[model samples]
Target: MLISGIHSRPKYAGLRVDRSGTHHIILSDTPRDIARMVEGLEPAPGPTEVWTVVGACTVTAAEERGPDGSVVRRAFRSRPLMFDMLGHRLARESMGLRLYAIGEEAFLWDVAALARSFGVDGDEIQLDHAGSERRRVFCVHCRAMTENVRTNIVACVGCGAHLTVRDHFSKRLAAFMGVQADAEVRGDLPPVEEIFR
Candidate 1:
């Protein structure tokens, strides 16, 4: 048997490449998940920085020392502060930059959308989640957007249609596709089940 197989490479082998750039780490309030994301990410040859978006909580000692070495931590008491900071940082056009985001599903996608708007390459950005699954869904019937949707079946606020949230996610809408839940039998409804539990 051969000593080395074709697919024996490490999971992060591709990320370990030597490059000249800054690594930007975005973390949420979950301590355990934050630690997990930063466990084995060592700094590249260039400068490294970490920015954490947290609520009114004290940063732990481990979080202070980021993947590279030191961390620049920021606390936000309101949503405006979070949006402002993310916008300001992403507005700066820099080619030698890598972005890593770890947070709730909604928060992570929000940050990702901002990063993409700034022309950040998909290959250069990494996203991870920490908290429960809260989804955003777009109603096809009335063109309405729903936020913090926790169930697979939701009633559309716009046209009063019972929407069945599909698994297909739309990147452009930043939400899951929602269709008429009762389209099959008109009056027949499926049993309700708790999602993101």
Candidate 2:
């Protein structure tokens, strides 16, 4: 399906939908409302992007006519609903803050909890996952501040889940967000473990 962007973000991400008939309607809905749209369809909300995959569909987001309107679209593969369900389960079980030594063969951080905290509002979760090969590591670089910390976690060339350096830069950010990583860091002046517990 080709989903021409009637109205969307300045930037976009790739996503897949399982259902064959559902329309990829892009409306002027808030992030929270977007979440609500697919909340019950998928039991656990994993990050996902909405794309039309079966037919040529255009959803006109409510807006006044303007000369400089921006529109963007991308192609996404459609999968069975069961695939999404499986991905959600695996994502919940094995995603998040997976770290490793710079050149070590084995994984460093056991990332079950990290996946639990990160979320997507009816869109694809930004975190990357392991691919077929196993020669890379996921790493997170964080910048801490008094008000908020920035975290950037990413899967490596071999496919590993990156940490959210922006979200988990400091213990304070973790604590404020009520995540385990923050709680562990709050006890110590410097972080003993780079990842959230």
Candidate 3:
């Protein structure tokens, strides 16, 4: 929790293998995150599946394969394709699924939201933050999202309002709320810094 008074801010407990889960599904947005994720889950006791957005990742066959060569893994060149496949897999599979995700804040919540839509319980999902600290900001004025924001204040993509990124987070939106920064004074703005990253 970054903000002392805000419970909405997410606090991450790093990924751990679910010992009793019959099936495991692990997901990550970037190569660096997934590499760190595989450590405790390489020789998983049961069937395991790894999904990653491999946009610029260089993956080897051994990396995709379990030590015993039984684990199943898939890489997608795009987030949409991987998300689509994830939805399908969740809908089709009926039992013993434990979902895990490791990546940036937005990516972590995105996976949780998707799993929630599929009737997955919060206790059944685990999230660990990795990679960049950049955030997805939702402009309160226009209800538009500003992706990968690294600064405390940013211009709204839709309404052109200068927004102040708040600690308040919405799992449904998978983003932090951004209110008009200079709403009171027309030209008075806070100093913008690369605080998120």
All candidates' TM-scores? Answer: 0.72, 0.17, 0.89
lDDT of 3 by residue, 60-110 (tens): 322467567767777777677778888988899776789988888988888
Candidate 2 lDDT tens digits, 56-147:
23433223322332222222232223234324544654333121111011111112123234442222222112211121222332222111
Instruction: Report the number of the highest-TM-score candidate.
Output: 3
- Against the true structure, what is every candidate's RMSD? 8.5, 19.2, 3.1
Q: Per-residue alpha-carbon lDDT of model 1 for 1-197, expressed as tens digits?
A: 11123342112211231254455544453434443455444433444545555455453323244344555555564444666766787787567677666655556666667778888756767666656776777898888988778876888878888888776666566676678878878967777666754
Q: Report the error of model 1 at residue 187, Å.
A: 3.4
Per-candidate total of colliding backbone pairs = 0, 18, 0
Runs in model 3 with CA error above 4 Å?
A: 1-5, 33-39, 56-64
Sequence-dependent TM-score of model 1: 0.72
Cα lDDT listed for each candidate: 0.60, 0.25, 0.81
For model 3, the local distance difference test gives 0.81
Q: Which candidate would rank higher by TM-score, 1 or 3?
A: 3
Best candidate (score: lDDT): 3
- Model 2, runs deviating above 4 Å: 1-14, 26-148, 151-188, 191-197
